[model samples]
Structures are given as C-alpha cells and as structure tokens.
Target chain A: MVESRRRSGRLASVPTSRNVKVSAGLVALFVVVVAAVAILVGGGDDGSDAPSERASSTTTTATSETSADAATLPPVVTDDPRLLGAPGSSGVTFTEFLDFECEGCRAAYPAVEELRKAYAGRVTFNIRYFPLPGHQNSRPAAIAVEAASQQGKLEEMYRRMFETQAEWGEKRESQAGTFRGFAEDLGLDMKRYDAAVADPATLRRVESDFAAGSALGVQGTPTFFVNERRIDPRSVDDLRNEIDAAIAGS
Target chain B: MTAAPAGTSSDAGVRRLGLVLLLAGILGLAASAELAIEKFRLLEDPLYVPPCTLGGAVDCGSVMTSDQASAFGFPNPFLGLAGFAGVLVAGLAVASGARPGRWFWLVVQAGMAFAVVFVHWLIFQGLYRVGALCPFCIAVWVATIPAFWYVTLHNLQDVAARPSRLGAVARIARENHGIVLTVWLLLVAALLVERFWAPWDSVFA
Candidate 1:
C-alpha cells in the first residue's frame, strides 16, 4: 500500500501542461454560474416600470442644470417639520428622510440630535416621513408622530420613538398600542390624538413626504441631504464634515 | 530503493502546500488585524466610522456594531489573529522541509474546517440579517475558503490511496481540486449577487 501510494504521489507531482485548459475551464465555469444565478434570481421580476421611473427621477434630481426651475430641483425641505434652525436661513440646511421604525434611523438618532444641538444656529435640520413598506409599524409610527405634531409634540414623540425602538421594532404585528402609549406618556389629549391618528389627511401628509423623498432618490431610511445635495455618510464624522463644509461654503 | 525519488516529489508537494498556507496566512492575518483595530476603535467611540465603510449596503460600521461581530464574547478577529499566526508558523516549518505526521495535518484540517463554517455563518448574517457587507470581513472570507479547500484536498490525497467508497469519492475530489475550488467560490459569489440584487441593479441602472 505504501509503495503504491509513493508511486501515485510521484505521478501526481509531475506538473501537467493543462494549466491553460484549466484557466479557460474555470473562466467558462464562472460565466455559466453567474448567468445561471442571474436567471434564477432575476426570474421573479415582472419587469416593473418602478425602477426605471426611480432611475430617471434620480438622474433629474441629481443634475444641476442651467435653468434654476423649481421642478428641476429636488424638494429638499417641503412643509416637513423642522427639528432645528429655520427655513430661508443663511446657514446650511440638513434634511433627513427617515422612518421611525428603522433600526438605522434609531441608531442615527443620537448623533443627529447631538449635531442639531452643536450646529443649532448654523445648520437647519428638517425631518421628512419616509415609512418603508417592510416595517409593519413604520407607517403607524409615522402617523403617531404626525399626530403628536398636531398637538405641538413632534420633537418629543420623535425622540420617544427612537429611544424605545428596540421594544417595538421588527415585530410582525402592529405596534399602534405602543405608539399610543407614547402619546399618552406625553400627556396628549387622547381624543384629539386618536382623531389625528385616524385622520386620512394625516396619512396623506406622511405619504406626500415619502413621495417627495422618492422623487429626490431617497431609497433607504435615514437618507441625508445637505444644502439639497445627497450625502452618503459612513460615520458621524462624515456627516459633521459635510455640515462644516456646507457652512463654510455658505 | 524507489523511496528516495518518491520522498523528493512528496517533499516538493509539501513545499508547494506550505507556500500556499504561508500566503493565505499572511492575507488572513492582515485582514484580521485590520478588523481588530477597527473593532477596538469603534468600541472606543460609537460614532467613529470605520475606514472600510462606503455607506449604503457596504457599510462596515453597521457590521462592526452588530452582535455577531463579537460572537464568543470577544471580537472574532482575535480568533483570526491567533489562528492565522499558527498557520503562518506551521507553513514556515513545513516549507523549510518539516515532514509533520498525520496528527499535524488533522489538527490543521480541523482548524480550517471551523474557519470555513464560521465564515459561511458570518456571510449568511451579513447578507440576510445584518443587511450590509464589511469589506474587511469579505477579505477574511476570501482568504479562508481557498485555504480550507486546499488543506482538505491535501488531506484527501492520503484518504484516496485507500480502497473504499469514501476513498473513491476522495480520489475524484482530489483529482478535480481546481474545479471544486472554483465552483465553491462561484457559489458564494452567486449568493452575494442574488442577495444584494436590488443594490446591484440600482448601480447598473
């Protein structure tokens, strides 16, 4: 057995001239595998026009053309609630399209609040509702906050939602009761709160913010825009730098 | 008699295997070290953005902050650091003509098997649960898979010499090592593409 093993090992040790063939085969296999995967994964798509519309809209919003038309520019800050600073301020404007139930938004809440405080007078901070369809509680949570906004408690409800996100986030069922509890905690008038929560106009207002965000190429939660330009920040420092740059430029 | 020639050839094969291990060990070590440093920095400052974070789906900041990053109550990269250093030393010894016994090979095989499994688990978490990709973690994965494959193949060569169904299977796999490795890597790539199809499509669109 040992003798035969030795012989086979010797045979295996002899380098073959099949290197090129092996390389070619590997490349071919890669192409075949990639193509197969693409077909299998992409098969479910019904060739919806949603992606194309988003693509064109993103392109239009991204480009700063010669004409300064209102339609050409993205609505960086519509009638969305302002958390800090004010409209028509000479300082830089920082806008965030966020879902209250999003983990990312919850994670970012503290840093954003800190920045709002740090650059209170210099940078304008605006919040736009962008309730993602995936989160079961997102729309309801947005509505709850919108309801709080009606009672002059938007900031309190907003902070409460993020602070207690872990308790109600990622649940399959509705968290309306939990949000209502938040409203109650804030000592809001339950009757008015319930009416506002149940109001179709409030929901439509939230949807309108989402529509504006979608038109501006906001694909994910906590998407930030500084001075009407989209900023993909990897860190709190990155966000701070962008704000600083914007302030400097302004 | 014929043992001298066979020994020389086997030694050469061991040398090649050692070289592979040495290179892979270096790569794994570097990636692990980088991740460890980044992990430490992140712990020090929650708001500190990792250098590898590219935002969106490719944010290392999100991955590092995840619970899985410290699976065993410590950073995963610490395991990488110690394991890769061992591999490096073993490879250096083997490449310099150390003919270790079967026990040595088996131990290395077990370590690599654990590494491969851990890496795949991390990949799954990164894709579905975490919903983000860490570039440094991906580098570690790339280093680990091929190292595990080659080590397994090397061990299978001995198993293939035996006459049994298992031996027969090992023989086929050993003979077609290139094909098997390529397929393994491609499958992982396919998974990545499939999982992040939305972001990928947006990029192209």
Candidate 2:
C-alpha cells in the first residue's frame, strides 16, 4: 500500500522538462503533417480566393460575347423553356441548372419563384434539366416537366413538381405514374401527354441539358448563372444581390 | 514528497477531469437533444427544412435523412443522450470527491473509446457519403473528442507506471497529451477541408 501510494505521488509530478521537449517535437511534427495535407489536398492551389478570381475572369470574358469568347462561354440558354421574361430581352439573363428531385432545388423554389415575380421583366429566367444520377426519380421528373412544356404548361408543372417534391422525391421506384397524374391534373390531352412523356426525344432533351450542365462545370443542382457567370449564392439575398448587380451592369 | 500534498494534487486532477466531463456532457447533451428534435420534426414533415440547413455543403436535412444517420436502426442521437447522461452522473460523482474503483475507470475508458470511434465514423459518413455537415452534429463531435482524449489520458497515467511496452507508450502519450489531442483535432479539420474544398473555395472565391 505504501509503495503504491509513492508511485501515485510520482505519477502526479513526472518532471516537466522531458514533457516540454516532447511537446515541442510533437508540435513540429504536426506542422509537417499540416503542410503535407495542405499540399496533397490543395493540389498547388494557393487559397480559396483562386476560384473567385477564375470566376471573375470568366465573367469578364463572357460579357464581351466576342466570337473568340463564344467557344469558352457555356450555352446558358438553348431552346430551354423560359420561366420568366422573353428571348432577346434587353434585361439580364439568368439561367439555373436544376434537378426536380434535389432538396436544395426544392428548398430554393420559393425564393426563385419570388425572384421571378419581383424581377419579372428585368431578368430572363430559364431552367435547364440536370437530373443527378443519385436521385432515382430526377430523370423521370425532368422528362415529365419536358412533356408538360410541350403543352405550354411548363411553368405550372414546374411549380407543381417543387410543391409535391416531398411526396415523390428520393423514392427508389420510378415516379412516372405520379408525374402522369400531375399531367392529368393540368388538364392536358392524355394521348399527347403520354406520347410526349414516352418520346425518346424528350429523354434526349433532358440528357442534352445534363450534358450542357456538365460541360459548364455544374456539379450540383440549382447552380445559377447570371449573364453567363456561375454564381454560388448561399441565400435568396445573395441571389437577389447578384441579379441586382447584373441589372446595374447591363 | 508528503502523501498529503501528493493526494491533494491527485484530487485536484480528478476534480479538473470531472469539470471537463461535466462541461462536455452538458454541451453534447444539448446538441444531441436538438438533433433528435430536428430529426423527429423531419420525420413528421418531409418538407420541413431544418434551421441549420444552410443549403449546399452545410445542409443538416440531407445528413439527417441519410441511411448512416440511423446506423443502429435508430437515430444516433439516442446513444448520445444516454451516454452523455451517464457522463454527467459520473462527473458529478467524481467532482464530489467520490474516488471510483478501477472497474469504474475501465468502464469510462471503454465507453470513451467507443464514442471516439463512433464519432469518427460519423464524421467520415458526413464528409464523404452524406456530403453535408450538421452544425449540431459538429458540436457533438467537438465535445466528444476532447472528453475521449482526456479520459483516455487519465487512464493512461495509471498504466504509465509499469515497465512494459504498453506502459512506455502510455507514458509518452500521457506526457504529450495536449499535443496529441491538438494533432488529432487538426487532422479531422484537415479531412473536412479536403472533402469540402470545392464549396469552400467557391464561397471565398
């Protein structure tokens, strides 16, 4: 018992000098580890500011729209149904690459709708189909919207898709019937709607949009572009600010 | 070398550990409870957006609804609730000068080890599989990590007295506890940065 007590006492005060030296060495080791991780992860990229700099450079080049720059700029609008404004509008053009089944897109739907209403005449809002492979129902949902667009009910079906996303999104099974139900509710000709929904061209159109989105560096849904400059807006306010700036610049 | 002063310092160390445990337990409990409530709300209403859903990389809704969130066929927060409650009680007992037996310390050590591993697994799932971060979950992570480290170190100090290989390692670890903990946390942070580099880069860009 006495020996144990003495050992406990020694354990409590195990001389600080060795500890200090070891701690210093460990800290130095930590610095090396951090440096290695930074190098590996960053892949020679200097800082977070580099992406913004690249974005700004693209923005400047896109604004000019010279024939030389056309190849570099993404095809922001290509026969895609316009949600607001019109073709050849003097106002700022806003395009969103989105997936119907994406939660973020659904979450942003209300804000995007409000923006469409607020900047109705000033911004030409267009949405391109970009159904991510992860979301099982995204492709079918996009095709449904494309079918609705055939009957001039694109906006109505688009709104309905977001409104009822909770019911059909993320399901492993195809929600084609549910989308057909939506088309029926929209009072479309059943024969025409069925043909359009089943048409290989409609599926092709969705795939083309996905391809375009991929080419434009869109990795996720609800990726917005204001006058051909991709903007990562954190909130509705950020999106609004981008639009306002675009309007001012135009 | 008087036993009285030696005992006092040892008591003070236990008291300090108890204090850390208390703080971590409270913080972790709060974070876990909040997550449980949010998860319940999400189940009740699929469209219900969590307040912590910052969109993009920081969405709690995506993380909560993920398969990994229910690793044990139940929400992981339930584990936190029970474990943190036990930690709270242990803290109270230790803080009030209750010198627990070896078995008690061993139990605590085992629980902490489980918690540390589970927390790191969840971190991996969040960063890679789920591709989103929950603020409350992050809080729980922050709280659990240090608690695990300190508890393990306290136990190590006991093993460190022996003249064996494990004892040598324990002594080294106990001696450089702060460095080890800091490095552990920094590595986790580095992983987080690496996983979400694109979003972070764009945000600052």
Candidate 3:
C-alpha cells in the first residue's frame, strides 16, 4: 500500500503543461474574489463609522466629543462605591467607561482585574457604566450591576457580568431572568433585586455614566481614562505598562 | 510543452489547488495576525486605529468589539491562526507530491468543512448582527470556501472509494462545482447588499 502511494506521489513531480481552461477559470475566480474583497473592505461603515443622515444626527446630540481630550476629566461616577484598589486620595487613577454587555469590555475585564490586584492601594481603579445603545441588554445589565453595588457587592456583580457574558451579551433581547439568576446566586434579597432593577433612579444612574463617558469623547466601549488622560492599550501587558508608567511618573 | 498524460492532468489540478491554498493560507495567516495584533493595540489605545479599519462601514473596530468576534469565548483570529497554518502546511505537502490514502483526504474534507461553515456564520453575524465587515475575517472566508470546495471535488473524483449513489453525485458535482460555488458566493454577496442597502446607498448619495 505504501509503495503504491509513493509511486502515485512520484508521478506528480514530472513537468506538465498547465490546463488553459482551469487557468482561465481560476483567473476569473481570482478577479471575482478581488472584487468581493474591495466591496467588503472599502465599503459599508458600521454603526459608529457609517456616514449618513445618522452621523449628522449624532453630531447634533453627541456634544461629548470636545471635552474628552484634556487630562483634567472630572471624577466619573463620583459618590459611587464602584471604586477598587487605592483610596480616592491616590493620585494614579484608572477610570474605565464600560458597557456591561460589550464584548470588548468583557475581554478587558480580566486585565482590569489584574491591574487592580497589582496596583492595590497604589492605584485607584474606578469603573463607570456606559451602556451602549447598540447592545440590547447593556442598560439592564448596567442597572443590575449598579443595583448590586448598592448592596455592597458592586465589584462582585461587575466581575459576574464578564464571567457570565456569553449567556446574555449579544442576544437580541434582555436576559433579565439570567441576571436575576445571577443575583440569586449572589444571595441578594430577591425583593430588593427586583425593585432595584425596576427603579427609574437605577436607570438614571447608568444613563448618567453614559453621559459622562460621551462627554469624555468615548466613542467606543471599554475606553480607559488613566489619571485624566485618555489611554488606549491593546493588551493586558500594554495596560499594565501604561499603568506602570503613570504610577512611576506620579 | 508536450501534452501531458491523461492521469497527469488531475495531478496538475491538485497542484493548482494546492498552490492556491498555499497563497491564500499564507496571506490569510498574515492578515489574521495583523488583525489580532492591531486589536490588542486598539484595546490599549482607542486612538490608534488599524490601517485596515478605514473608518466608516469598513471599521475593524466595530466588528472586533462585537460579541461574535469572540464566538467561542475567545478571539476568532486565534482559530484563523491555527487553521491557516495547517492549510499552509497541507498545501506545501500536496505541492511536493505527497500522495496519501483516503484518510488524509477525509481529514482535509472535515477541516475545510468546519472552516467554511464557521466563516459563513461569521459573515452572517457581521452583516446582520455585528453590522460591520471585518476585513481579515473575510480573507479567511474566501480562502476557506474554495479550499473546502476543491477538497470536496478531489474526494469525489475517486469513484471506488465513494458509495454508489455518492459516486454519481460526485461526478455530477465535479463538473459543476465552479458554477455551484459562484452561485453560492453570489447569494452571500446579494445578502450583504440587501442587508447594508441603506449604508450602501448613502455612499453614492
């Protein structure tokens, strides 16, 4: 069997002329593929990037683009217990504007957790909710997490969101049941959990963070403001390095 | 060049497909790496946009941030990295005239099938749910589809190995695979145009 296979393989090595029909066919396919790539890559902007009547609409409502540049950002979500690592007196502050249901924020959650651990007491890590309109469940999820904060389990719910993100992150509708399940798992008072999630004030708190994030020129999810300076780091290492630099400089 | 033997033509066909896969695999590998790296970079600094992002509808950022980008609870590009590397190696082996038994072809069939299906799922998600196109993922999509198609064609050509009904089915498909693939791709393209009609029209407007 092996010998016959070797013989079949050896036959393939001999020089042979290419088939014109197949060549032409492949070339045609190549042209078509090239066209597809052009259309795929060069056209069709997504929700944030698409320029249309929509962008013009955003320009009118989203005045947050200008005030976000300078490093003197007002404290995001002040009076909230969503602070971890270091007291408010700590000068090296790491502020992240996040959507609870945003996949990018989920991806960054572990890294943020790491930053909190490594810089414990030396850096202030404050998380602010900024549920994006595109995510169907983000607002509800933020309210749940915020409501958890009221019961002194804010950090627990923040971690819970990322841990269970796959369950409800990109769904077309709200997974209030799943979040209620999470609250149950956390052993929260069911009555308060339901009440907090239903409260108009809870919704307003999440909205306020969104407003603050928008004012900071945060166009996307998981935007981090370190020491009032907007910083974009691509990985956990990149984030740690940035934090390290900020702490060292401070 | 002299006319090659009848049997040799099929070998040349396999060689051509292998060469195509090799090129696509290498290019896809590069693109996937660029995408994953640039994504990490963008995460670190939102201001640093990838060149491929291009902004507007061609935004890699929008697509990458979508839940579908990490469908399996991890970045999809990591899958591309492994899958394209395997394709590149397989292409090199085929081009070097390594004739294998039925098992190798079956494995190729399975791998390509998985890749093509996953790519299409991603494509649908990008167009409908994610509402953006990820350039690197599309490169993998094109490569995986053809690789799967040709491998399917190659497997069917062996009449003895195929079941009686499948043998006839394969013979029919072998002759018409190109047209079938073209139609399939056209349907996908049509969906994209339809799904993004508003933005597409806005471009010209």
Candidate 4:
C-alpha cells in the first residue's frame, strides 16, 4: 500500500514552500518560452525569409548575390526546350525550372510572358521541366509537354499546359488523359504523341531536366535563373529589374 | 497541492519523470501552437511561409498542405494543443507530489500510447507521403516520444502488482527505462536519417 510506502519514506516527500515556488517558477518560465516561440516563429513557411518585395525596394544588399557558386548552377544545355528567345540570343540567358502543376509557375506565367514581350531580342528564355514529385499530375503533364515539343508545338503546348493547370493540378490521380486531349487539340500526331507519352525516353527527358535543376539547388518549382544566378524575386518588377540589370551589365 | 491522493507515494524517480513530462509537454505545446498559427496564416494568405521552413530540407508548408496534416478530420496540431495541455497539467500534478491512482495511470497510458502511435504515423507520412518534414511537427514528435516513454515507465512502476509474466518486464521498465527510451528514440532518429539521407547528408557535405 501506498500509505505504508509514504510512511517508510520510499516516496518523494511533499516539496517545501521554496521548492514549490521553484517548480511554479519553472512552469511559468516554460509558459513564457512557449508563448515566445509561438509569437516569434508562428508565420507560415515563407515567414522565415525576408519579404523580398520590401527588401528589394528598400535595401540594395538583399538582392545583390544569389547562389554565387557557379559550380552548383545548371549548365546552359543546348538541346533543352527554348522559348521567348533562342539559346545565346543576345545578352542575358534567362532559364526557369517550372512545374505545370505548380501554382507558383502559373502565376509567374503572365509576368514571364510580359518579360518576353519587353525584352524580346535581348534575352534568351529557356524553360525546363522540374515537375515536383508532390504534384499529382505534374510529371505526366511534363512528359505530355515534351512530347508535344517533338511535334513543333512546344510553345503553344507549354502555354496551354499552364492555362489548363487548374484542371489537373493537385488531383489525387494522374490526368494524363486530359494532357493527351491537349495534345490532340494541338494537332500533335496522335501516334507520335502516344508513343512519346508511353516511352521511357520521354519520361527520362523530363527526369534529366529535374536532375539538372536538382544539381543547381532548385528546391521548388518556378525557380528562375538570370545567367546562372538564382533569382527569387517577389514581383514581376523585381524580375524585370533583375533582367534589365543583367541586360545592362552585359 | 490540495489534490494529492491520500496515502500516495511519489518517489524520486516519479518526480524526475514528472518533471521530464512537464518539460516535454510544454515544448510539444509550443510546437503545436506555432504549427497551428502557421496553418491559419497560410489559410489567410497563400503566399505566407512558415518560420520553421528554412529551406527545402525543412518545409512546413508542403507538409501542412498534405492530406495527412488533417488525418482526424481536423488539423493534427489541434489535437496536440488539447493533448499537451493535459500532459502539462498531469505532469505538474505528479511533480507536486500527487501519486495517481490506477484509473489515472490508465488514462495517462491511453493518452501516451495514442501519442506514440500517432507520432509514428506522422513520421511515415512526413517521410514517404508528404515528402517534406515540418520542423515544428518534428519538434512535437521529439517531445511526444519522451513524454510517452517516461509516462509508460512510471505507470508500470506505479502498478507494482503485475501478473507473474509481466513482473519481469515491469522490473526492467523501472530499472532500465532510460535505456529503453534512448534506444526507442534512436530508432526514430535512424528512420528520419534513412528517409532523408540525401538532403541530410548534403547538409553535412
């Protein structure tokens, strides 16, 4: 019995007033620390980073350097899909690793489109497939786009993929059929399209881009590179500013 | 202090276990609150990034948006808020010389058992399904494991009168409980390392 154990001093004695105060103080300290952590680190994932929009407009130091380690940057591969401007068009080489199923990429589309219009001949825009594993239909969609590329509808199919991303992005299952429909609408030869989508080589093609992006520390989709420098800008303005700076510097 | 069970025995080991649980509960509660706050912020503003998400290796957003974040039809951190509060209170009581009865110990056992199981399930989801580790959730996992371990060991110590078959196990639970906890935690850490080997190794490299 517990009573006997208590009498025999086999149990911890009730703390004295001082010890009680210490325990209470410790609890209070823990409460304060917990509150502090909640208040300090409670922002969503992007909270950890400085607000790039504010940082860029206010301080020059924020956007000065980006992944300066050139070794980690992806090489300007010659055969990968090209957009806006061809490879080595003029001054700056603008490469983006984008995921069709990623919302960030969808949002960046308009800005990138505008950028293409603004700096048509001055910059070479290259888009690479970096279908994140988490996006349900991104990989299949990437393969579909690449397949369409073989049929000379690369630009049109690429735009269509972004335009129709909402139809398939984040779905629980693959929407390869919807993508196939897109290919059909684009007038890609159904046989070639079917063969490309079904082939290991097409998937491997996408995988190669992903591997290249992975090497360059591309953690998320919509990763932009201005002449092999990582650019995580907040707005189209920031992106344009960087491009303009790159153009001017070149 | 007033609720100390009559004729109760609170030994040094139980006191230490109580303190450990108390601290773990507070830590778990903090992580839970931070996660909950970040989740709500994300709902309000889709572009918001959680502070715990430092880089690709530690991203709460990817993990939070996953289906596993709401396994019980509600956010898991909501469960943590309620569960860790209970743990905090129970731990404080135990530390303050309250020797719990059988029913109380059973309740603690149930809570801790559920926590341990849920932690493992979340670990699986984080590694394989969600494909990202939320730093705050990982902190919660770390706190919950020790809370469960110490509580279960203390509960076993409390029972004292086990069946002949369980007697040896109880003795070991009491005598070598720290080792048991350490090994169990090491197993969890090993799983995490194995799951994120490339990214984890890259950090060191």
Candidate with maximal DockQ: 1
Interface RMSD of each: 9.6, 9.9, 9.8, 13.0
Q: List candidate 1 segments past 4 Å from native.
A: A1-9, A13-24, A32-75, A78-93, A120-124, A226-250, B1-9, B37-75, B130-135, B154-158, B194-205
lDDT by residue (tens digit), candidate 1, A11-118? 442222132256458778878877786667655643232211111111111111233455875578665554633443555788888888776677678888898888
Which is the better candidate, 3 or 4, if ranked by lDDT? 4
Q: Comparing 1 and 2 by DockQ, which wins?
A: 1
User: Tens digit of lDDT per residue, candidate 3, span A204-232?
Assistant: 98888887778777766678877667776
Per-prediction DockQ scores? 0.24, 0.14, 0.14, 0.06
lDDT of 2 by residue, B1-205 (tens): 1111211235656765677788889989999999999988766544456788654366677787766889999999999999998888887888777889878989998998999899999998888666677789988998899888777767766567778888778766765565666677777887876666655544444
The model with the greater TM-score, 1 or 4, is 1
lDDT of each: 0.73, 0.72, 0.68, 0.69
iRMSD of prediction 1: 9.6
Choose 1 or 3, whichever is better by DockQ.
1
Q: How does residue B178 of candidate 2 score in lDDT?
A: 56
Alpha carbon lDDT of residue A143, candidate 1? 97
Q: What share of the true interface contacts does each candidate keep?
A: 0.10, 0.03, 0.04, 0.01
TM-score of each: 0.75, 0.58, 0.65, 0.60
Candidate 2: regions farther than 4 A off: A1-74, A84-90, B1-20, B23-93, B96-129, B132-139, B145-205
